[model samples]
Target: MKAARFHAARDIRVEDVPAPGAPGPTQVLVKNQFCGICGTDLHEYLGGPIFIPTAPHSYTGGQVPQILGHEYSGVVEAVGSQVTSVKPGDRVSIQPMVSPRDDYYGRRGQYQLSEQLAIIGLSHPWGGMAEYSLVEDYNAIPMPDDLSTEHAALIEPTAVTVYATHRGGVKPGDSVLVAGAGPIGQLQVMAARAAGATRIFLVDLNDNRLEMAHRLVEGLITLNPGSTDVLREVRARTAGGVGVDVAFECVGAEAPLGLCLEAVRRQGVVVQVGMQGKPPALDGFTLTYKDVDLRGSWCYSTLMWPQVAALIASGQLPAEKVVTRHIALDDVVEQGFEALLDKAGTQLKILIEL
Candidate 1:
């Protein structure tokens, strides 16, 4: 089997590796069809060992030189004796999260918040970038026959945005302000719309991404801090000069976080959907005076795979709209990862077709 393994920063190699032969009981062996390179993968390529463990991970025991590709779709090549959710020849999207131990959070059905969380591809031995990978039966959620493999690969990332909306408590007729127009941000707009947000505003420094967001969602208001005063523009559009009902900070930066805090209406919610590199300073005054609710949205719930898959399959989410390019596994580093690394780049979700 050929796999792309992360050796170190800027060192991802495509080479032949020993194949994961068979599935263990309660596991599934999948022949990967399509995989999407995620922002986490890019961070590892640039300067990491962040999530990719340098030592043995506490849960999965996976170390560096890890295979990378969590957002993927594949067909079941084989299933273990105990597997019942899926069988051979069934197409499915990989859920990626693996909860090895029954922690307090896992016991409560909040597996994503488990203290010893180990994600497939990042901390687990097998990953979607390869031709074949192994996953627990629970991680392989079968897709509808009408769904394309490319769309199925998008389910994982879509889960992130959907979970963010859930955390923000987005409801019908509410307004939303999303800061950052990257792939996740674009999906946030769609998810917010699906949640019945009537008016949506998107802010990004990159005009290209803003334009992409506009095309993805009809009637989206895009603001570029470069030209437009985003805070002023957003407030002006809202009723009574009050800000949006819910604001999401998808850029994972101080400025964007600040923008989200300032752009949300009084007593509104601000969900931090992006992974911040460092602890960002919060405006205590705004938080205290405005009675704003600041919340952090990590990965999606372990049980959300089915719901997200259905949304994509039904065309309510349109996860496929974010896929900007497709490349082979051999071209993942140059064409897939590097293309997305370009700040002025037009690429969004670049899928590696195996």
Candidate 2:
């Protein structure tokens, strides 16, 4: 099978590799259909061995040279005897988390936070970029026939946005301020709208991204923070000298993180949805005096996958329109990597169709 394997920074190459070994008792073999390139993948490819705790020899799954995709959908080609949730020929979206189902976290329904967690494609034997991927039955969520593989591939990332929005507790009448308009940020806006945010303010330096955000959602007021003072504008627009009810920080950079803290109302919720390369300074004085609630969110749970899938299928959430471009597996370099890196905020989601 031909898989795009990451060797070093700016050094991903497609290589012919052996197919996945036979499924384990709880495993299922899925024929790859669609995979989404993620920001973490970009970070790893640009400058990383990334995070492989056990190494020396590495892997596409459960190891390094990691096939490196967590967002994807595939068809079940076969399954081991113990796989009862999905049978041969079933269409499923991969959840990608490896956790003991009977463990304390699993029993308490927070398996995403379990100590034994290992993500597929990141730490497994095979990933969706290859012809087939090996995943445990528990990681396979059956996507409905109404959902396309393109949309099914979205469940993973959309799940992240959904979880973050839910964590922020955006209510129907609340106002939201989103710090970035990247793919995740756009999804975060959509999730905020669904959760009942009446007004949304998106701040990004790029006009292209702000325009995309304006066209994507109705009644979203955007700001080019490069030209205007976003904090000043937000304060002027909202009642009192303070800002929005909820502020979602979607860019990991220092400026955006700082602005998120400055833009929210006193005692408002601020969820840090982005991963920063370096730690940004916190406003200890503001937190001490103003009582701002700062929270960090990670990836979503299995329970949220079904809801994300339903949102996409129902078209209440415009995940499909967010796809800026689609490329074949062979052209991932030109269409996926360089274009994304070079253009940055200009493009939204880029898809790899199998």
Candidate 1 residues lying further than 4 Å off, grouped into runs, are none
Worst 10 residues of 2 by lDDT: 52-61
User: Per-residue lDDT of 215-305 in model 1, one digit per residue for the tens?
Assistant: 7778899998989988888889998899999999988889899989899999999999999999989899998899999999998988998
Clashes of each: 0, 8
Task: Write one digit per residue (lDDT tens) for candidate 2, span 1-354.
Answer: 888777677877878888888898988989989998887778877778675434732322255576767789999988998888999888899998777767789888898887777777666666777778888888888989899877899888888888998889888789899998888888888888878888789988888888888766788989988899898889888877678999999988888877888888999888999998888888778765768899898888777778999998997787876788988878888788777787556667888887
- TM-score against native, each model: 0.98, 0.95
Model 2 off-target regions past 4 Å?
52-61
Q: List the pairs of residues colliding in candidate 1.
A: none
**Candidate 2, residue 64: how far the Cα is off, in Å:** 2.4
Candidate 1, position 239, lDDT:
88
In model 1, the worst 10-residue window by lDDT is: 98-107
